[model samples]
Target: MRRELKPLQLADCAPLGTEVTDTDPRMIYHGEMIPVMTPDVAQGIKDARRTLRTNRFRPTGKRMSMIIDGCAGKTTLLLQIGRAYQGLLETERRPDSVWTPVVHINVPPRRESNMDWSLPFADFFGMDHTINIEKRNYRSTDMTEPVVHHMKESGTSLILIDGVDRIHDSELTTAFDYFDCLQDRLRLSIIYCGRGATDIVSEGLHHRRRGERLRTSQQFRSSLPVMEIKPIPFREGAVEEWRSVLKAYDENLVLYHHEPGSLLDFETLLHERTGGYMDTLDQLICQTAQQAIEDGTETITEEGLNDMVVGRQDAEDDWA
Candidate 1:
């Protein structure tokens, strides 16, 4: 298949603004968890997979994946889904344990060392590193063999890999493809976490690095499960839960945070501020509260938020 196709992105479903006239330190605070909101797309993925299996067809277990770009609560949602999946599998009659529980892995961080994933995997599991890090033998391929084997036996059927774009393209692709093959061997389900549209999953099924150690030069790769998790839509349900929490700290959060009453202006403003990402919204509100505390203000108002941002920006510029 030589046809070229574009992957669906959040931008496609919902238009969002990109330009930022200025940045604020408190903006980072908007990236916390808002547990009340539902992960609708993720739930749909799980539901669809379950339905297929219940129908008695040969169901290739679907991997639940979310792309956590800088703004989206990808990792948070992944954890949420994992928790829900755990509850479902814990039932006495269910065979979820036979499938892999959630296995969380990362690609590697940027501006760091050579990003050997085996290190984190080993350290996370309290397993010995293939060799002493100080030793020269650590970089060789032989060391990763044991780490790979342990992962296979680790009973991780549902793999959730974050930091996907952090590693070298070729190396990351190799490691991802290897796990995908394990799915064929052991019926493992694959879930990926990454940035932008790197096309990792499609390429994964095409390359059979383990069986033939071979490459599928075929043009179009198969699609693994993918959902570009955008932020939550601005509404009463979304804001009400978080706003209630924020009200205990700074009352200013409730300024626009009324009973969502189907108001487009409020909805648009909230969504604009939050971009629908629950974590980002939480951070913003939390920062507002922290600023209120620092300013020695008891009740926060709309004026307070503006004053806080202006004061912080000025302070940051002075320090710079």
Candidate 2:
């Protein structure tokens, strides 16, 4: 027998916040993923997964980069991949043994030194004790080797380095040199996530010292293949598709869709406002959902979206 429909509660919907929850398996397995996948992003995932699988035994000593604009969902995709890979590793784990297939670390913001870059790895792999010992006995530049050794021991085949763009312009050469050393020593497949290629390549060109120029130039055109993320376009059926996804999540979820001024109208407005960026779209959905719950209407309307815009503007004004 078919059950009676009820308004979907906000608590039932996926949680939304500033933190990147894309890697959370609960959300992903429950079909809360962003419904759009560009060809570039799709191909990049395929290539990266293939490299990881291939190098798991053969040791490719190759690396790849996924370049996307800020808030273009690079971290989301990387986290998703990491979660999936870690799940696979869990199945193969021996009794009382740990296997970590993917190690993800974010490059520290506003710092561009090898020490800063290597510290996250030590922390991620829980090698802080070893790192501290090395710090007391050896120079800061020597800390990375122990981390690399720990990674190898842990059966980590794929390393995802997020926020590579955070590396300062002055430290670009050092950053690339460190990456090169990791590739040479570890023989593992790596994926570097950054905002855009221009910033990454330009940093090398603009700031490299005279002696480092030739070497840095050679590394600038990375041997690793590059994947560039393109913005998801606002299309004719975008709203309908998004609505269908929402329905999949909760059939009783009410949304505004009048004939002349339909949901597509609001979608079109949003697309124009956000330039089809996924992050902004996510924010809109979250804001609308929260507003719907608070109003006890269980319905999303153009007015609600307008309110979100005004609210955001007011917040910014307050800050200003």
What are the Cα lDDT values of the candidates? 0.45, 0.57
- What lDDT would candidate 1 get against the real structure? 0.45
* Candidate 2 worst ten-residue window by lDDT: 1-10
Which residues of candidate 2, in runs, are more than 4 Å off? Answer: 1-40, 57-71, 88-97, 110-113, 129-142, 198-222, 235-265, 310-320
lDDT string, candidate 2, 1-320, tens digits: 01122334435544433232544332232223233444445666676667666666663435443343344777766665566556655678752344566778888664466776687877787664333464576334435878887877777766777887776657788776776677667776667777764457444435554233344434554335566655556577555544433333333233322133244546565655556565666666566655554554445677787667622233344575
Clashes of each: 10, 0
User: In lDDT terms, which candidate is top?
Assistant: 2
- Residue pairs with backbone atoms closer than 3 Å in model 2 (clashes): none
Q: Identify the candidate with maximal TM-score.
A: 2
Location of the lowest summed lDDT over 10 successive residues in candidate 1: 1-10
